[model samples]
Target chain A: MILPSAIALGREFAGARFQIAPVRGLSVQDGLVIGSVLVLIACYLLPLGAVVALSFLVPVPGIGNYWSIFQNATVHAVVGKTLWISSLTVGLTLLLGYITAYALVQAGPVARKLMLAGVLLPLWISVLVRNYAWIALLSPGGIVNSILIRWGWLDQPVSLVRNSFGVVLGMVHYMLPYAILPIYAQMARIDSTLPHLARSLGASPRQAFIRVFLPLSRPGLAAAAFLTSIMSLGFYLTPAMLGGGKTVMVAEFISIQVTETLRWDIATTLSTLLLLVTGALVWRFSHLLELATAKPKT
Target chain B: MSDFTYDTGYMQHLEQSVRRETQGKTVHRRRFLQVLSALGVSIGSLSFLPSARAQQSELVVANWGGDALPAQRDILAAEFVKRYPQIHVAFDTTGPTPGKIKALVESDNVSWDVADRNLLSALELGRQGLLEKVDESIVDINAVPSQFRTEWGVGSYFFSFVITYDAVRFGSTPPRTWKDFWDLQTFKGKRALRNNVEGVLESALLADGVAPDKLYPLNVNRGLDKVRQIKAETIFYSNTSEAQQLLRSGEVSIGSLWSTRAQGVKEDTKGRIDYHFNEGILLIAAWNVLKGAKNVKDAWRWVALSQDPYLQVALLKKLGWGPINPAANKLVPAELQAQNPGSPENIARQIVVDAEWYARNYFEVQNRYLDVLAA
Candidate 1:
């Protein structure tokens, strides 16, 4: 009886398969996919949805919070400063990171290992420690000034830390490792002989680098720029500590609102705006990445 | 092929066992899910459990941590426990910012019984109904000055933002007033100011020739203008420790620093750094009870115990904090009298911060102050 039923069921399954190709029934994999999507909704989207809802509801409902964002001059100044500092940080990080990545690509094995260690070791240290170290080196009576003064380089100690320049410097230091790894990874993938091949073909070394090497490194440069700029936009500690309370960024402004002023509406609104800006940036970068990768390789 | 069995009974047995195994797995999976859901519910509801029951005998005091924690534990907690052995005292070192207090009360989870915060914060939170009123019968309401006392809280201690100057830099003639601090030609050196509105605005006003008695209803524009005059030469410190470092390292010749931190810096530099209470902006730190505190009785008792003249003097000695209880002034040693902010001579020279005015205008003033600093 069992054999007859099994044979009948197999025949029915075979008959159904003949109707549509690749139309398989749900299985364990499908269950897993649905479960993960549900988890994402519950954990990530739900809390974010609450924040967005709060932005509209608090201090009386409607778009009042967003309107305040426009009317408030402090917010405008802070946002403008953040954008300026972030752009400066990105430009400096990319230039310095590209040089380091190029050196890493050209170094021999032992030198490469040592150089890699130099780049990555600071990441292992705490950001607080690193920023404080910068202070110790850059302050008026700090080591840098002491050395300069001893060498008769100046009449008085120059102000180094506690300004936009100091903030950018610390930011560039932090962002270098993040930028270097990606650029290094991309540069390492390029054929080592390509620039040499250009040199062999009667091209000057400078022309070879500009024509052959630089174009190949565009994707990595773009990735590094995108990463550094996004990270810089949200920086709080480096600017707060090194900026001497002058370089107020958006993150610190939001913090002041949340903790000091107790203006949850303003904090949430700024947070939502930051999220949207980050999302837009991610969207724009993805397109750039696509364009970079889509370009024909020389 | 010769050994293979094509028997219907054998095939039927195999199919039956497979069906039984899958059925067992389904039952096991269902049981596991049931247990998981039960755990989730229990864990989620745990927050709603009556915290008061577990904390009946225990009182939690929250304050800004650092040196104050040890000083509080050794002086205030030790003395309180001696008085009531049955009660246990605990501490939450996370500073009780107004934001945290508001959140705790609004969420109906008031974990801290006593919170050490500023008079401005107490006024703000008290008006919002987030703090419990001080029980006049239990607490000695008149121990501190009437201005420092309120229905919602009492002054726990006093600290002032005094002019701290590097004696090594300006040993002959130190800055005694905010006007001298702003005098670049007479006393030319970099200056440090706290990057907050509380003491800063008052100092700026005082420097701009606004009399101490006429300081309230602060001329913010005038104050900002005075601050901008020295803005290029000033480095604003956000934390008290940063102020100490700036002065101690000779980075700034003069700075406005909390009296406690100034004292520490003076000691650290062996009197090379000195601060005078002259023209200081005296600020009060208050002890407030949370609205739904579990150990309200114990909290009141703690506040009352903290006001003991001897204990207040001990706290002053240990932490350089000025005693809130005026009675503690007589108990302070002659050597410490000059250093204490509450000393009659010192208190007369300084102006107490107007908490009522600050509570009303702090939010806007702080924003403007930060804007000026950033600019």
Candidate 2:
């Protein structure tokens, strides 16, 4: 019995040594990749954890923060506006992005490259700079107004900024690039022969597009809309800049609560609600995605 | 216009979080150097890093960026370092907000040692026990006015929301008072007001014939009604930079703006733009040390150095901020004193904002103001 126990101990030590030896043999690149992943986890997950924990803990524990969402009139109005604006942004982005992506897929190589550059150019510039540029162009004395007035369109410059119209215009411009890339990626993957096959089967061009092309692009459309809507919900800068101080949104209001009012209760409550709404949206889209991709019953 | 400024308490928490991330990188670099030294590496470049770091203690000072930061660096931080060669000062040019200060203190990982914050922010945070008690042993507060000094902070500077106008457009006569600012028949042009409810409420009340001394416990309805009369023509600005840009471009003939910004624009435009402190709403800015700051002792010393009258005068000359130390005003030359908001001549004409009243009723007032604006 003693001999058997000694043997078991030796086996355990050997197993631990084997694990240690393999770790020592790890290449520099392998170590670096692992290190990078750990850094990402520490940087991203830790703050996310704090925000999540705070959402429940603030203004007294037990979902009191979440409860305030239904109680406050200002919060209610802001959330309604946020949903309306985000939906409108998603629709506009999808329509414009689909047209642009389709054009890119059908264009010649040189034209495609140029168009791609145009789509990607704004991504390179900082959002703050781009928003400022939009402000300069859209303000009453801005270039657009100057040209319109010069061409005798109106006797005076009209108010084009500091309102809902300006907010939507700025948001749509910022979201277009995000919307374009996914649809374009999916469009590039389509088989060129499918549409041709539909056409050869006695279908008209429009019918070929509707029957074959559009169905294939549904995933891309959904993805683009999902991405744009989620992004639009968190937008703070564009609306704040273009809408002036008059047009308030959820994110901006959350920020104001945290900074000006020092009301962590309200800020956390709004944030938790926003998180839930975003999560619900993503879940709904993924559910639709699963249904679409599910194999037919044999 | 910028998103955040000294007076605007927004986005400071984001800036502080970003600063904390960068501080992590500096720590890593120090650790890397330590490891190199342990390996017996004798590079001369590496030697300087440890030696320089070991000799001097670092203190982080927070202030508003854009013009105020560089002036503070030159007049205050640089001067402090010069006086105490053993100390090194770094300016974190993210404007202060009470929320960020509380976050730093509660986390017990304070990155900023000295914060340039407004009076109400300091009061609110101090009341919450988030700031270090002012080290009276190392610093003196007697020179600062009683209204501006608290147990946790001493006033750094003063500013006012002064009426500014385009000189070319209103060459003969500019809008001199809140009443003139409200009168559209005479000015006959678009005007700009801060997007803030605090200044707007005060100005409206003042314009509607509410005495400055009697403006406390504000009449919400009367102020709102006054604001509504001219709401159609007034463009609201979110920051000083935007307000300056609008005025500089002659887009708005008359506007209410911070004194420092108006002065800067006046100089930049060669006096095509101008403002006066008559009927200005005075605000006091303070510098407080964080509760858990690593360099509290040095931070107190640095704050003390800023109280020097000569340095304060130099600050007033460079930036249009009024010196909080009364001695600084005496040191300021007569010519520049005309522009100094702290000078007795100017202070008498301006009404000091009731900090205590604001600390209690700010949120209620802010929400009501937002409701008014939205309507």
Candidate 3:
């Protein structure tokens, strides 16, 4: 019985040794691909995982963090604000971007190039600088306020940067590009003659646009809305700077909680919630066209 | 679908997008790691540079982002090397204290040997057991203000949070208290407040008529309500950079800003701006040595040199941050007493933030505060 057991053990050892051999050059290309994919996934998920882990960890084990969401009035309010801002930003940006893209397609080549250049110029300048510029434009003593004051539009410098209006304006300015590019790309692909032909056939411009153009541009519109929503939801500096003190968004609130209250669990909980919100939005975006255009099974 | 490609411009733009996206993928895959490695080399060199003697290992000292940080750090470096020739001091900078310390400690890869953390974060980390208690013998705590020195941080006083405004904008009637700030009808057009909790709450309560000395065990609900009330009307700035820019550009006429930044505004404008100490919040950045630091002796010597009044005064004059060393009084020929936060007299008036309290309650208050604003 001992001899038979030893023989079986030796066979198992030999099999294990056999498994270790000839991994040599066996598709290092495949290994590289697999390794690269693993690294990329790890890179993406690890930080997110850590954030989630941090969220659930304190108040000494339980669903304390998740439960705290209900207890914390601030978290609930900020989340609502985030949703409102994101929706408004997406809606406005898509409308404006579509208009600009349409205008670009209609303009003369030189005019279009210049217009395109103007549209993309904000992309190059710093967001901080642009936000500051907006502040300058909106402040009471600054250009806009000075002009409004001179023009007798208002008695004093209206509070712009410190309010939600300013926040929206600045965000829309940034989000406009997100809306513009995709729609413009879609519009350029659309046949110019379709609208012209519709006009010749007695279709009004509005009808032609609604019937012909809107459906064709669904992908771009979806894309623009999706992109704008994601960006608007995650904005920290814009709301913090432009909103002044009156408006507090999720990002600013998270920083405040961590720094001022030292409530690590709550802070992480909020951050994790934000991540989930954005992640869900991203998932929605990735499947936007699919969900919107899905056909019923016969 | 085929008729979609419009003109040359559109085609060119499309081409550019395709090219850019393709390049982004390449950069993300291969170039990202390459660039990271390259940056890692430079950053590694800065933070772990070998000694000139090639005998001793490196001690990395991480600090803030600014012209002033480098200037102060340079003096510390020179003096550090003068006394102990064997050891080398390497410096690094991370953007903010809370996020950076959390990242370093949680990652279990302590990238920093020593870091610049303020009183609040220092105390917070000390409670969390993230910092190594300073070697008392080397630190010479007797030279430090008893109030300033703590188990976690060695105080090198920076600045007080002073309310600075455009003198031209405010006229003779400057803001005397947080109440002055609350009365937006008189002090109109966007008023500013720092986004952080400790100071803002104190200011809001002070505006609500809470005495500075009695600020702590702060009435959280009352403070949150005040914050919401002010936040409903006031604009908030999070970063120092944003606040300074807004003030300089005349985007904001009145806001609570760093004393150094406020002083810079005053000095830059030849006193066109005025900084009021009526209800300032005192904050100081303290040097903290990490627990796992490989070069403790070197870090201590560096800390010792950093304690010098000459160096401190030079730092005071050159950089806007106030010097902690009482000896810096004369080296700084400027009459800092009444004006600068570091000055002996100015330091007395401002509310001392109970950082220990902040460390404990920051998140709860911040969340509540934000909620109130959103509401």
Candidate 4:
């Protein structure tokens, strides 16, 4: 009986050793892919998971934090203000970006290169540096004011920086590149002859351009608006700097809760809400785009 | 559908990008393990290095990081090392936020032996048991002002949120008090206040005619109402630098600013800008030994060294810091007394911020204050 028990133990040990070998049927590429996925999950997904979980857990379990959002008038005002500002920012960015992209596409080689460089140069500079530059240019005694005063543009210096106007200006400046790039990519792919063909078919220049060129750019326009609005919704630094504490956006408000108040529950809850709103906006916009583009060509 | 080759379709593009990224993965196991071991060895050795020096008697001090922080550290370390020559003194210029201090202590890996923190922060952390006792045996409690010293920390220096204005912008009648600061009709142009609820609310209440002594258990509603009156004209500054910039650029004619930052503007503008300490709110920064510090005894000694009247006066003279020790006041030069928050005249007029009140009600008050500001 003792001999049989020893043999059984040896057999179990052999089975355990066999299990330690490389997983069967997994090629090197498959192993690499699995490892990559694991790394991604560990590095990125886990921390995000913690944030979501903490939103529910802190300041007592349940939805007390979320419930308070409705009770507070300030959150309502801030959310309303953020949405309004973002919509304005999207509109301005889309208009400016379309014009800039159109000019870039129409310009000669050297001019096109120069225009593109001008558009992208601001992107290279640090956000803090850019904001500071805006402050220098827009402040009451700044270069722009000084220039305007010297040129007799107005009697008193304009209240440019540290207001809603300043925040939108800073945001539009930051977002122009994001808007322009996608629209430009789509514009570049369009056949340049479509508008000309319409004109040749006895359509007026304006009519041809509106009928052919405008409709063709709808997809790009939608994509640009979607990207700009999403980016605008989460803007913190530019608004904080240029808004000058008056025009408080959602991101800055969330941070104030985290750093100043140390109410992690409120911070995480508001963050989760912002995330949900952003997702809904993207979904709604994508569906709208699908509906618009789904129509057959005339 | 074929015309939908916009960037070759988003999904296909993502797949191609992933393929491009994975194609660069020629990681040999030996090389990978060697790199991993290299990282491990460096990190392991780095951890061991501090412990090895701990055996040799060393103390690490942490403070705010900036261009000026190094100069401040060098001055303090020079004085500290003079008396304690046996123990090596080093400085870490990572600013001590409550979050960072709590993180270090909670993780049971407290690298900071001594840290410069605000009085309220020390009390809050002390209550949480994240900081050691002040070691009163070493740090002479009697020398420090009764209000400044605590069981967990000793005051480093005193500063104030005083009224500063652009001399060019504001005519002869510059705003002198918090009342004048709130008097938007008389004091024209934009006004700036610290974004935080601390000194800001105190200023608001003072402007609202609340007595200095009666400022505790702050009338949050009245203060908020007062702030709201000027909220349209006021642009709140998040930091001292921003406040200084607002004053310097003439974006704001009047600003509620720290004495140090006001002095900075005055010096930067060659006396074109100035500040008055009338109704200034007093704030103190204190030094505390972090809990589970490797060199607690040495940290206590360092804290003790800071209490020396001579060193306090020297710091006052050099850095414009108001000495915490009451004895250091007599030693301060007459010319610097005007800038010193601890001076008899300044202290008489200024309100000492109730640190105990703040430590207890900071979060709840701050949430309401933010709401009020947002509204």
Name the candidate that leads on TM-score: 1
Q: Name the better of 1 and 3 by lDDT.
A: 1
Over the stretch A89-111, how does candidate 3's per-residue lDDT look in tens digits? Answer: 88888889999988998899999
What RMSD does each model have against the real structure? Answer: 12.8, 11.1, 12.9, 12.5
Candidate 1 has a TM-score of: 0.84
Overall lDDT per candidate, in order of appearance: 0.83, 0.78, 0.70, 0.77
Best by lDDT: 1
Question: Which stretch of 10 consecutive residues in model 2 chain A shows the poorest summed lDDT?
Answer: A13-22
Worst 10 residues of 1 chain B by lDDT: B23-32
lDDT of 2 by residue, B285-308 (tens): 878888878789998998888888
B1-375, model 4: which lDDT tens digit per residue?
222234547755465344323221211222223343644633232121121222337687777665347555667678777878787776666466665565566545566788877788778789989799988778787777688877888787888899898777676888888898999888888898887888888999999999888998888889888989999889888877888878777788889888867887888998778897889999988887899987998898887877777878777766667888887888998998988878989888888998998889887877676676666
Error of 4 at B225 (Å): 1.3
- Model 4, range A1-298, lDDT digits (tens) per residue? 9788767666555445443224689755676788789768644554455456657766576888889877777788788889999999999999999998888777899998898999999999898998889889988889998999999997799878888999999999999998887677667666888888998999999998788887887777888888898899999998899987878888998877754565667777888888888889887887644543354454
Q: Give the Å error, residue A216, model 4.
A: 2.1
Flag clash pairs in model 1: none
TM-score, predicted candidate 3 vs. hidden true structure = 0.77
Q: State the DockQ, from 0 to 1, for candidate 1.
A: 0.29
Provide the lDDT at A247 for model 2.
66
Scanning candidate 3 chain A in windows of ten residues, the lowest lDDT window is: A289-298
**Two-chain DockQ for each candidate model:** 0.29, 0.19, 0.27, 0.22
Best-to-worst TM-score order: 1, 4, 2, 3
* Candidate 1 structure quality by residue, lDDT tens digits, B8-97: 777654654443232211212222223335446333432212333343788889888888899999999998999999998888776777
Model 3 stretches with alpha carbons more than 4 Å out: A1-39, A56-63, A104-129, A152-154, A181-220, A251-298, B1-56, B320-334, B340-344
